[model samples]
Target: MKRLRTSIRVKLTIATLIPLVTAIALCWVVGASIITSRFSSQALYTVETSLNSAHELFLGEQSRLSDIIRLTSRLPELAENLSTSGPTASVAPLRLLLGNEHLSFLTLVDRNGLVRYRAANPSFNGDSRIGDKIVSAALKGAVTSGITVLQAEQAGRENPQLPGKMVIRLKATPHAYTSSKTMEERGLFLVASAPVLGSDGKLLGAVYGGILINSDNRLVDRITSVVFQQGDTDARVRGNATMFLDNIRIATTVRDEQDKPAIGSLMSEEVFAAISRGTKWIGRAFVLKEHYFTAYEPLRDLAGAVVGALYVGMPERPLMQLRSQVNIIFSCVLLFLTIIGVTLSAWIGSKMTRPVRALADGARRITAGEDLPDIHVDSHDEIAELADEFNIMKHRLAIREDENRALNHTLEQKVMERTAQLEEKNQQLLAAQKELAESERLAAVGMLASGVAHEINNPLAIIRGNAELLEMTATLDNPANEEVETIIRQTDRIERIVRNLLTFSRSGIKRLSLVSLGILVDDILDQVGHQIPLDQYRIVRNYRDGEIEVEGDEGQLRQVFTNLIVNGLQAMEGGGMLTVETSLNMAQQQANITITDSGPGISAEQREKIFTPFFTTKRDGTGLGLAISYGIVTDHAGEIRINGEVGTGAVFTVVLPLRQKEVDELS
Candidate 1:
């Protein structure tokens, strides 16, 4: 098994990051733990404080009821009427007391515990007493303050329940035919009692008054308003206050999940049990359908027995959300720190490896026998000392290399001299081999052309002789004379094709002369005009309005330009420009003629075979014209080449060496 290789940078990064990541992870763990614990504690404290505030307001309300009841009993007019007149008393003073918005129910009972007056139900004044602990105690001449569930028909039970003030139905109800007073259980009240005595302090009757907190308003709203004030926390999340009589939630600002008043739901079993024991349960508890950070305090009777509980709860969702937001902020901070650590790690890695990389590169250069610049040893360290030693070794090696080069230089000179002589001989041998191959190729082609020409010449001679006979012997108006004329023309074309093949195969010579290329091109075009559709093309002669003389075979040069021009004209199937340009090539001591056409151009593949004997692009071509033309140009010590692309057209250039002797004669 192979272990992977690492550079100095990787080692440095690993060494740095292990401790960095470990420290960060440790810090993160500790921070999250501390933050969550603190949030839990602080959040509970807020809820408990709210609960305490609500409880204080509730107690104050109880005291206010106590004050109203005790104050009414002390009224001088009330004591005088009740004592002198009893059950049939005027009772106008008690009516005035019940008018207080805070007071929900008010009554006066005689010493026999019979109702003398009822403020809530005025027509039922002589009804049986509203017997609760406070009322009972009050009738017994003992002043009391407490929460008591008034008897049916006492706490406005006899008063018809309005259709609009419906509570959530929790229990089974009596039949519709059943009397509402017989089946209904009235809700709880915060009541106060004080004995009504005569002016002599003799017990005459008792005044019982209370504020009903059942399905009640303003009182619970006041508790919530006092406990939770507006701030960063939303009022809905601040949650509302609730009071429960035993298991029944009687008066509340708390709402169900639907946002309606949660007037009929019970407390969680844990919270209910704890409050039933008359102790505060402070923490998270499920009530209704949601969870809250809550506090529950017992609501006791005047005898100091727990009969109900006062509760304040703040919804847990907001507290948990704030906690999550804090955690996210810390997480983002951790992420930023991690990114910084990674960046610093990379920088430190580079710093550690940079010098080592430079040293390795320098060593490689020296080992390969390359001259090296001096390395600066800026550090006062062992690495710097090592660089100094390396520079000394490099200097010694450079000196040794110089001495070795001097010795090798003389030996290399002798070898180069011998190698040059050998290369010259090799070139001479290759030239001779090429000449021999060419001579053999020419001999074979000539033999084949001579045989084919001889066979065609016999028929051509017979055809020409017969045409002459017809021209001399045939009479005018003979239709056969026209056919005979056509025969002569066709035979002449065949004869030219045979002549071209022979010239190409034999590499034939011609009479050399100083020729005007302009006159020669014009003569060739005049001859071609009769054979081709010359009127279908635009002939552009750009011969520079002067004569440029060149040393060449007059007959062969004419054939070359003629073939080029005719090929150009024939290629223009849709009728196009045919240009013949002649110029002097002063630089190369030559005269140039160019024939170009606006026609479907020659391609690279076709150009290669254009001057090859027996190869042609045309359907009825003997393929000998350009071959003979190529041979004739080469024999005259001149050059010819085709230039073309796929769609632009073709230009054939013939460059003939100028005659220096002819130039001197002309001058």
Candidate 2:
């Protein structure tokens, strides 16, 4: 084991594995810490928020109940009539009133602590605690209120011998009629109670009402339903929430899978204790055999006593799923970073080792006095530069070796040539001198063509300008309009021909200037407009919405466009469309202008030499048009290309750089 560990391969493996393992371990530790802290904080915040919302909802329910009570109390006639009428007559009107108010039961009691009237079905006979807490308190002239839990089974048994059964009970305090009685003997009921007062500010009687909290699970279920819906389903209440009075469960909105009620179940001890403190609590706890993040807030009565609690919660499955997804993404990122680091380290190590090996080999060759070969290295870093310097040193040694070989060869030749050679060498030198003169003569003739082209260009420009001025000023109504226009047009054509000649002769301006392509196109079109039949050809312009400026000579570019457009018009003897489009080129800081013509396109064989000087297909054509255009554009550091198909016509694309100043500012 020790020997295996000490091996170089094992050591290298350990070195690589140790760091990667350490990094992965650290990533997991950090990720877990963050996840735990953030998840706990988010859970706590969610619990607190839900508790607050439940408290507000409970308070709203109390306020709604109070509003209904107040509305009932305003009917002083009903209270007065209930005190005077018999039990049967009073029961019908009271039942109607209770039904309208959405109360489960309504009752009226006398001051003697007896139930005089009851609105609910299945009579109580005033046997229960009819005038209990509320009645006693009201008799003493104190407004009394309290909520009570009523079991449907127990309450129903009281009326099992009657025609129908009552599923709930109600009780009131300080009976309606005036009588002497102790508060304890009033036989008050186990339900909510309220005092019925008269306008004279005297205690008229009491009105008691009770709702089967267990039967009204719909309200709590609706409150606990999720506010937002996802996927294809609507939001729903997923978990149970039970209202607890003191330590006992009063009612619950929980339902089984079959939609059967799961009420009357004992409340959890932890949740009960939390509510008893009169402070809100929330955390992961089991509800209906499933774990959830449950929120509980104490419900307070008018006197600020803890009467019950409102509970709301949701399952933690969604949060667990989210945590799993985050872990997967983190793992992927770590793996990607690890791969990149390994690749970079290996590449750098190889890069450092290769040059050192080459440098050592070159040094040995130089020491041996052998002709050294060139070494090539391709990095713009310090190590590459060092290798470059070493190569230079090797090159110097190789030159020295060559010179020594030449000197040795000369010495041997000298010994052999001593007898007879001087006369023959002089005759050979004369023949070489004669050949050099002939080459110089041909070079002089080429220079003459450029000079002649320059001399002719100036005269042509002068004649063209005068002819244009005359045509512009001349009246069109004159009988000589056709003749004069022809002269002007022909002069412009001659000037274009001369400009091409100058380009072929290599005698035009060498300076680049900012020239707007839009203006250049307009000038070229104007010069060649009359030459082409207007009725036969259609010209289309698709220029972009700005000045298309480039660095080139305006006159030379105008000559280029003039030649292209005229050739396009002549190609389609039957006439066709000539489309010119312009836009900016992204990578090349230049303007791209393309001219396409719907004419018989160039054949593949003719396309190759189309830009060669003096290569024409027409009898009267000088064929210098495209060639000179190509040369002039090339001189401006621009590119021109021709794309054509046998049947689909041709497209010529010219790309010229923007002026240096514009390019610099844009950059």
Candidate 3:
């Protein structure tokens, strides 16, 4: 056992080395982490910035195309030639402008989008371009310019060399989804179209010109020169740019193993997905079998559809090499410091542990039942002071050991008594909280009732008085008389609602009277049309053979049933059945009233809090109707329950004793 254990000097040496080595290791880890994160962040930012530049350059080209077409369409000589002479007469000026602008095709179309003059092939000029977005937009007096795709036949008709120039054989690529297509024949173009209006602003025709993108590396090479120009020779080719028609590359500076531009290669599947969704992808991606920090942004046509993508990528190898160099230098420096620290720590531990060894020897002797005197040391420092204090501690420790035994016993008893007292106090506190909540709820109801009654009564009185005077003066045959009666009726309904609110605020049933559930339901049903339009709802009633009477405060009971009926009507908002069923339980001498609504029923979690004060699912509910009804029913020695499941609708059932005498007897 002793052989397995290490000495204090060894422990101190290891402790000193642990933190020093840990701190050095942590420093290396943090440095490497920061460097790696910074490199990644900077790489993405650079590629994204390059992508922005490419987009601007692409837009600038489109703007230049639009400018050329605009200038050509507005020329007086060309317009006059087309308006007076044959279509062939205008072909001379169009051909001159098309060659000067280096455009692949230039043509003039009539107001119906029919080709009238073709600068490239004047004889082939009767096709309709009305189906094309650019042509359609321009013919409607708009000057539109953007990327657009042309079919192979259309390109062939415009220029005999275009179909051959647009053909590109697809090449297999790593990290790209395999496609069955072997060749891309559609031509992607930067096109601009403008309306050719006459001197009087009349639509005479339209003019459009474009440059083919497939097999043309000029645009992508220009983007590379502008974006990667600041870098060295090696870095110049490290950053590449590409233009893709969908996922297939039409033009690119990215080269394959043969050092040829990989124009027909497909983009990585992940990048294709992002571009397809009209979003930008910025991260590390494998392009042409080499990893690069790349950014791909969707290229949209004039119709705002994602027809292709634009990409810019920077090589990740250079940044990774820099990070490797930094790590190598950092590790070497830390290794040198660690070697020096280990040597110094061993020497210091040996010197400091000599006195400590002596103390250990003394303790061992005491443990072996041998009496020893005070420990002494030669050094006049804290180590020497420690020896004197150690002797005093040995003497005081014996006396304190006995005192602790008694103190521990007394502490356990006090803890038990305090725990019992805390449990009792907790119970009292819980009871107090419940009472306080109820009191606060009552106080809020009283305040709301007082404020509402004060604010609405004066205005209601004025309205009612004016309505009565109008009712007296209006003739029986007057159409407005019916509207006047409706106003007076609604005013009375508002007064009754206010009275009910004041009663609910009191939180009790003040008087008891006989209420016929069947008759009461019918009366409220007849009056509910004033509350809400009932054209969409179907009312259903199933009453017992005789009237079922209950002894309750008539006004309070009326409020309860009215609230339920109105709630049922509101719930079936899209037009469903509102069912009122009343039955007498002869065995229990209780009357049962049920109001069912074909509405989306309440869930279990909602049912738990359905009758809680200020809890409601309605958007604009005050959340007190059910709570008030619950209180009134309980005061009358009655029970109210809700039964239903989600999607089946809810049924609210209220059961009351047949008479007040029966309720008293049961209580």
Q: In model 1, what is the error at residue 19, expressed in angstroms? A: 3.6
Candidate 3: worst 10 consecutive residues by lDDT? 450-459
Off by over 4 Å in 2: 1-36, 85-88, 126-131, 140-145, 151-192, 225-240, 245-266, 276-279, 299-308, 356-667
Candidate 2: RMSD over Cα atoms?
Answer: 23.0
Query: What total of clashing residue pairs does each candidate reach?
Result: 0, 17, 0
Each prediction's whole-model lDDT (CA): 0.71, 0.61, 0.81
lDDT of 1 by residue, 1-667 (tens): 9999898777777777778777877777777778767877877898888877887787788887888888888888766667754465457777776675446667777776677777666676666664556767887777778786655444443233411232334422222112223222456668788889887888888888776666775777787777776453334566678887765666777765676666756667777778878899999887666677888888887678887788887787865686678678767776887778778878977875666677889999877878879786567777788878888878887668667777699779989999999999999999999999999998777655744553354335546655665677747556666647656764665655455455544545455677888787876675565457577799989977388888765655766776777788878997999999988868888888888999999999999899887788887666766776787787777789799897999989888788633221100
At residue 437, give the lDDT of candidate 1.
100
Sorting all predicted structures by lDDT, with the top scorer first, yields 3, 1, 2
- Give the distance in Å from residue 624's predicted Cα in candidate 3 to where it truly belongs: 21
Candidate 3 lDDT, 440-548, residue by residue in tens: 8977876566444533443355456546657677465665576567566656656655665565546543566678888888977876665577899999999965687
Off by over 4 Å in 1: 125-131, 151-168, 171-186, 231-234, 303-305, 358-377, 385-667
Best by lDDT: 3
Per-residue error for 374 in candidate 3, Å, reads 11
